[model samples]
Target: MSKKIREKKSTLFSLLFIAAVILLTLWSLSRAEDPDKLIKDIQNASPVFLVLAVLCVLAFICLQGVVIWLQCRSLKLQESLWRCVLVAFHGYFYCSITPMQSGGPPIQIYDLKKEGIHISVGTLIILMETFLFKVVLVILSLGMLLFGHRLMRRYIWPGLFFFILGTILTCGIVVLIYLSMFHSGLLRRLILWLFRKLEKHHLVRSKKGRVEKLISAMDKYRAAAGYFRNQRKLAVLLLAVTMLQRLAYFSTTYFIYRSFGLYGVSYWTIVLLQAAISICADMLPIPGGVGITEALFQVFFRDIFGTMTIPGLCLSRGITFYAQLLFCGIFSIAARVAFRVDKSRLGFFQTSFIVPEDAP
Candidate 1:
């Protein structure tokens, strides 16, 4: 299919998914004795907590920029921090609309190329950032499984089996991606062997070009691995920053819980639940994990907090996902406008900063 058709389809699906999520959230609330009263209760909850929840969401957005900035600096890219922030918002806008966030990296790479970074470097930066992000996610989910298995069995749907399966799959994918960049000898042999088999079966016209591309990517990965290894301190700092980024993002749930004054579950337990939700969401094909998040929230919190699950879902999603979606969507548009204006003034040749040809 054409790109335009795919985009239109994605837009249509995103709209429908978002509507479904809204309806599901409403339905959850409607189960209450009085839905309006429950909303009123949420509104009447601690104002401080509400504000903190918003701040935490905002912090989450900013921390993504920090992760990119640090990784870019490690690669010797001199892009401005504001550019990183714009990239984060712009990526979020696309990611929120596309299924499984498949649209995000391309947009980010396009934006970075416009800023004068080479496409190759931009891709590496994104890959490194994504690797660290996935690492943090896998670690958090494993922590939940190890320390909160009882809660998982009791609350999460599909119980321990589902959680373990999802977490293992996610971690395995991440580990393979990481290993591909640094230790790809086995992967390269396997890929080449598969391509050779296809050629022998007359399935492919030519294997030479595709094999070259695979080798090129393997080289890029090796370079990235070596560069990062030489910058061990920066690598450690990037990991820590990524962890903080997730904590700030997930802490939105904690603040939202406090906003409703339901303290039955400890903060740690809530974090674990949020981690599980994230793991499940990754497994889902839905855009923004809309329906899946609502379903998981209901399943995970209902028995624990009774009717408070309704408000919890409402406030948690309202403050975190929906709020971020709306705000970042607008910010992305504004950034594009500003970038266009700046580009017009600077001319194409002057837009990008020169990097050393030999540098990774």
Candidate 2:
């Protein structure tokens, strides 16, 4: 772990990452089916219907912004909920376009900093919000897997048990490490000993450090079980947000199917359709899930569409993916320009920024 060896390892890793990026870029471009057809699919959306869909998406983004703002305020930021919502919209617009579902926070952080929030607080809020979001997603996913989806309902009881056990075990390990390494003197001594050795090899430097500064700031209101520690309540609220998101979308799909003359589709059918489409689209990993999502809807609804599979699939996918993505990008541009969000581009979380010494 000397400087020379570290340099060599870094170079090797960089080369590997670059090679992987090149492969992915190529694989993605080569998979593009037809430019004209994609255009048609997006344009196939009626202007009026598309406008309505866009409004729904806007509402979705605003709700997310509000929740994030509330969370930040609870964490002691002085930003308005409305401003936060606009930032959220801009962030989602970017995350939607990029792979790994990243983007949204850094831009908002920069904007908020201009409005007087310390950059460090902005960064902290993003991390906290993301942690809450993920916790909610996992809980909701577990619920859906247990009782919501028919496929899951059949085989997932045992799977559910195992999943819960796995989650608990993971949490136990993490808590153990946190308690032992950071909060316990004996464990802290062991960690420091290791760090010194590693430091000699130029791996980790500065054994004497107050790592708890970050942890204590986040746990600022732990005595009152302030917002940061109320993960369960936050998870519930975020679960509601997550459910609203899924419900609005599936309901829209049901309406779209009706518009297309597929009558009498049940509530469960919509859930099934949305779940199947989402699971498949997520696996694709392409920005917006593009071709993968469309193909999924088509395959899932093939029975309903009969021989008109392609158009039927495109119709559903259009409402969910291409159309929504286009509207998000357009609205994002409008919101950014209208509200003067800096950078014109942003991401999910702010990784670095300044902080007032006494803010926390």
Candidate 3:
């Protein structure tokens, strides 16, 4: 396809995705048993706690940007913190609209390319970030599942199947990444073996060219992995930042619980419950896990929120997901425009080649 045609199609798809997210948000709002009562309750929520909840979300975004910036710095790249934060907002915008959050990393790599970061290096950064986040999330969820068994049995019993599925999927991805990093040859052999089987069944064409490209990509990936393996301090720093980022996000639920003026539940309880909800939501193939997330919130916290369950859902989902969608969407567009203008003023040429010495 022509370049301009491809750009237009991408823009069209993004607009359609945004529209779908808006409709889903509205549908979730309509699910409240009493719309008027829900509105009243939300309006009456403590502004102080709501603002804190919003700050937690901001922290989540900023911390992710910090992680990216740190990764770039570790590689001796000279990118600024603000620019990296914009990259994080860009990621959040796409992730919230796409199913399984699958569209974010590729688009983020494109954004990073515009920033003069090579695609392979950007891919490695994203891979490490994802790996750390999932590892932390699994650790936290497992802790909650083991210690808070009664809590899970009491409230989240119905959704136990989803929690298990999400755990398996998350762990599977982590294992695949580990293999790609430490056992690239074995992984390459396994993948090519599978590809040849499909080829034999006449399921694929142009096997030679595609296989060559795949091998090249895996070589770069393996090189990047070696960089991380050698930088133990940077790896540990990234893990710490990832854990804080996740906790900042999970804390949003606790702040929302406080906003409702109901005070019996401990902060730890609310945070762990939110963590459990996140585990169940992570592997679902829904856009932003919208419907499933809301349903799980209602199922898990129905007793804790008492009669205010629907209102809490509205407020919590509104701030964390819908409001975030709006903010990140606008920020992504503004940042893209700013980038284009800056590029135009600088009159720089785009360089797509990666220097061997600069690899990783």
RMSD of 3: 4.7
Backbone clash count, each prediction separately: 0, 6, 0
As for candidate 1, its clashing pairs are none
TM-score of 3: 0.84
lDDT of 3 by residue, 121-224 (tens): 67888877778888987897677678878877888788888888887888887888777667777977988899888888989875458888777766766666
Q: Candidate 1 overall Cα lDDT vs. reference? A: 0.73
**What lDDT does model 2 reach?**
0.52
| Candidate 2: RMSD to truth | 8.8
**Alpha-carbon error at 80 in model 3, in Å?**
0.9
> Higher-lDDT candidate among 1 and 2?
1
Local accuracy by lDDT, each model: 0.73, 0.52, 0.78
**Where is model 3 poorest over a 10-residue stretch in terms of lDDT?**
341-350
Ranking by lDDT: 3, 1, 2
lDDT tens per residue, model 1, 256-308: 77777777778877777877788877655678877677777778777655767
**Top TM-score model:** 3
